[model samples]
Target: MVDAKDLSLAPRLLPISLSVEAGQVVHLIGPNGSGKSTLLELLSGLEVPQSGSVWLQGQPVSGQTRYDLAQVRGYLMQQQRPAFVMVVFEYLNLVLDSVQLATGEIRDKAVADVVSRLAISDKLHRRIDSLSGGEWQRVRLAGVLLQVSKALNPHACLLLLDEPSTGLDVAQQAVIYQEITALAREQEIAIIMANHDLNRTLEHADTVVVLQQGRIVSLGPPKAVLTDRLLSDVFATPLEQVSTANGPVIMRASSS
Candidate 1:
């Protein structure tokens, strides 16, 4: 469980209180510079809040050591550009071994499992510098997931992801979302993912929180919170919420 009370980060995030239980996926959506990333950072203990407090599992985050907090939370930032060169497999191995004290075979198996799951097995031996944007994003995501899976208590872990599907195409995005959903369901990992793709978030998230200018304009189930009024108001643009054969969709409104 993660509880944040009146979290404020000055100009980036306002005082916001949120509670997340295990086995849930909460999607954060908003335009650029809306404090989506700031909130995730506070929850992950990466940044200290100016006025608020965060509690992870039952202890205050301020009191927990960095390593102690890291053992229970995994964070994936939106951008990562490696300065040093390394093969994809080597990089992933480093991440898996960070919090995992397993045997070599067990660690190797864990790395291979996530590599295959993200469909980046082909690039395992490839140099990280050679990977395309999408490829690197997948490898980074795989590393984050592997780190969380190696947590001291997997069932109590939390995953904080920012635009996790930034460079993936449609098919790859689907696979990543599926894996994320499974992690929340099967492993009971509480996940907070910030994404701009409304359609995908609606499909996979259990709850949606829409923020604008560091304020939550709406929060609830995707269908209930993503109305035409809500989307248009927060986005400052015309959007139509339509009921489609597949499900509900938010579409850009045609010019009048």
Candidate 2:
């Protein structure tokens, strides 16, 4: 569980409050410079809020508590560039090495599970620096997922992701979201992800938090919060909600 209460970061982030329960997938949606990244950083303990507080599993998050938080949380930032020319497997092994697992077999199984979920099994032997942008993104995501997997941290209950599907194609994006859903529903890891893709948020998110100029405008189930007027107002564009077999889809309103 994660709780951010009245969080503020000066001009960039305002008093934002949110709580994510175990097994829930919450999406943060807003335009650029809407403070999604700032909120995530505050919750991840990467940055301390000027006002208010963030709590993880009942412990307050601060610079001093970050080390303890890392034991139960995993954060995937917006950008990741491999500096070294290590193979994917080697890089993943390094990540696993940082955590205390019960056995080598457990580490191997964790790696296999995350790599398969992200569809990166084939890239295991490839150089991390040489992989395509999407491949590298998936590799980084796998590393983060492995950190929170039961094999690494059984107490891992929070996963924070900022624009996680950055370089992937549509299908790969779907795969990533599917894995996110599985982590929440199956592993009971509370997930808070900042994303630009609204439709995907509608499909996958149990709750959506809409931000504007550093403050929360709406926070609720996706369908209720992502109404036509709300989407148009938040995005500063004319939009419409259309019904489909899958669910309601938000789209640009027709001029005609």
Candidate 3:
């Protein structure tokens, strides 16, 4: 669980407050530079807030050191490019080291489990730089999951993802969303993610927070927060939510 109150990050983000509970999936959606990423950074303790406070499970994030916070939350940024030459398995060993988990069959099993879940089992021996965009996304996500597993209570860990579905294709994006939902339901890991795909957010998010001009415009269920009027007003264009067999789809309004 996480909470933020009276949060301000200058022109990028105005004062805002929000809370996330265990087994919940909260989505932050807004236009470019609308403070989605800034909010995540604040919650993850990657950046100290200019004002307000972020609490993890009850304790103030400010009191926690960077390493201390890492144990409670796993964050995957929007842009993650491999900087050095390392194979997938080797990369995972580094993650395990940071978490202070032991290496051996135990670590091997952990890495295997994550890659298997993300369906990247064959890429363990491949270099990070050689992976396709989707493959790289899965690999990075696997590292985040690995970190959560090493937590004192994996189920209590918070997952903060910034556009996690960035490089994945449609099917792969669905897979990642499904995995996130499963993590919340089965593992009780609270997840807060920022995404540009409204439909995906609608399908998987337990709650949606709509931000505009660095302030919250609406926050509620997809149906309540993503109405025709709200979408049109927030985005400064005519928009509508159409109910289809699949689910609610946000679309541009027909001119006619």
Candidate 4:
């Protein structure tokens, strides 16, 4: 549903090309300054690349097409700052207000579904400024999801998230990832997320794109691309992949 061809943004992002199809969860994994955020911005049409092109749903992603693209794509940046002090429900209502919903019932159902999935039902009455880091992140995410939900935008086909699990604890992270995977599968939406946790990517991502110094080192299924040798070289550390009952885990290679 989304295609980026030879995308480049000066020194930060090098030539990159990739495509995301419906019901696919593509993860971008790399260390600091590897251009994960740059790539996402390019795909979201938040920033135009110096070279190459990004297309969403077959339309070129430029300032001219952003208005139409906005209806079908949801993007959550790594950092979010609340613009004003408002109740969680109020903030969410404002997001839904932008979309053309069928009726009050439809709006209510959309809000309920996103809040429940993000586990922020209890925070509806709370002020945005009063929530903890994790709570705030979930609220931000809920807003994005609600804006592009099928009830609001039946044409919704793409979701771009950057470090979505920023401040959440382990349990919360697990819940969020599960919800994310379900969203992609059930809604048939193509998802591209920049994540730091290799194990989490392995568990949830249908495909993995490993980056290093602003270029793609490897791209494929997590188990195939995230091998011990590749990760060790890309991360510039001694790392190993171990087999466990749960799944394959990436860890620092023990020095003995």
Candidate 5:
């Protein structure tokens, strides 16, 4: 469990007191600059909160080395530009080889499987900078996957992705979400992803937390909370919506 007891990050996130349970897939949905990433950063301890405490699994999560916290959680920020200029596979290897695995072949095979699932198998030899934005995002996500798998046991991983679906096409986006769903179900990892894909996020999420102006506007089950009024109020725009055969689809109205 991640608890934010009156957490505050100045000039960024408004003070918030929120608690998210384990095995819950929650999406912090908000418009750009609505403190989604700031909330994430504060929770992940990338930025120190101005006030309050963060408790992970009932223990205070701060006052420790960043490397120590990495063991309990894995955070993927909004952007991960290539600073090292390494091959994609090498990066995967770097993440994969960090943990002490009993079998070399098994480790390599697992890394390969993760790369395949993220749809970056063909780009294994390509340098990160040489690939497109979406491809690099996948590679970085794959590295995250590998890192988490390598370090964490089942039922004890927190995957916090800030705007994960940003650069992907529809198919790629689906794959990314599917991967998240599988992790939550199969590995029992807690997932908190931020995205603008309201429909997809709602469909995949167990719960949705709506934020506006750094404040949590609403929090509940997706179907109950994703109403037109909530959408319009949180986004500060008139969002047209419909409950279709599938699920709630939020649309934008164009002035005609």
Candidate 6:
């Protein structure tokens, strides 16, 4: 569980309290400068909150050591900036290996299943350098999923994702949503993902948190919290909410 109790950041995020249970995906969304990324970093143990607490499983999130935290949570940052030369399958093997010292027995089957689901089975033997940007993100997500799953112990596996769809195509984004859903149900992973695309998050997330000026302006389920009136007031624009067969999608006009 991710229990953030009245946590505050550098100069904002005042009186913020949130609870996310296992088998759930909570989407954090707001404007570019709203400090969504900062909140994610705090939750991921990369940054410490100035006050209050970020609790995981029953302990403070920031109190854990970096190495110990990595075992319990898998965080995918907004940028896929790492440079690596390993093949896709080999990279997947490396992730599984990091799960434990005695993981060779279950490694093969786990890698096969994750790759197959991400639609990267064919790209397995190919070096990651040869794959496209979207392909690499899928590979990254597969690695994250495997790591979080391995860390589970009769409880939820926490995952922190910061704008993970930055470089993904529409189809690839769809696959990621599916994987997130399945992981919550099958592996009981609790995800707190910061998303720049509010439309996508509103449609799929179990909970939505909005940050503004480093503060949480709103937090709730999608339909209940995201309103055209609220968006207009916060974004200083006449935002439109269009209802599609899938769900509501917000559209913003350009200033130019």
| Top candidate (lDDT) | 2
Candidate no. 1 TM-score: 0.95
- The lDDT per prediction is 0.86, 0.88, 0.86, 0.87, 0.79, 0.78
Residue 128 in candidate 5 has what lDDT?
A: 79
lDDT per residue for candidate 4 within 128-148, as digits (tens), equals 889998999999889888766
Compute each candidate's TM-score over C-alphas. Answer: 0.95, 0.96, 0.94, 0.96, 0.92, 0.88
Residue 131 in model 4: shift from native, Å? Answer: 1.2
User: Candidate 4 clashing pairs?
Assistant: none
- Superposed by TM-score, candidate 2 places the C-alpha of residue 147 at a distance from the truth, in angstroms, of 0.6
Give the residue spans of candidate 4 off by over 4 A.
none
Residues 85-169, candidate 2: write the lDDT tens digits.
8999988877766665345777778788789878899999998778899999999899889888876778789999999999999
The total of clashing pairs for model 4 equals 0
lDDT of 3 by residue, 50-158 (tens): 8999988889998678778877888998867767899998887777677676567776777777788788999989999998888998989988877876333343469
Question: Could you tell me which residue pairs clash in candidate 6?
Answer: 13-214
Worst 10 residues of 2 by lDDT: 94-103
lDDT of 6 by residue, 1-256 (tens): 7888877776645557789898888998878778777777778888878887888988887767876787778888875635768888778767656655225546567767778888889998888888788888888888887777643223336989887776788887888888888878788789889887768877788889877787778888887788887787777778767788876788884456
lDDT of 2 at 44: 91
Between prediction 1 and prediction 3, the one with superior TM-score is 1
- Candidate 2 collision pairs: none
Candidate 1 lDDT over 108-214, as tens digits, reads: 77777888989999998999999999999999998888877733335347899999999999999998999899889988899999999999877888999999999
Residue 32 displacement in candidate 3 (angstroms): 0.6
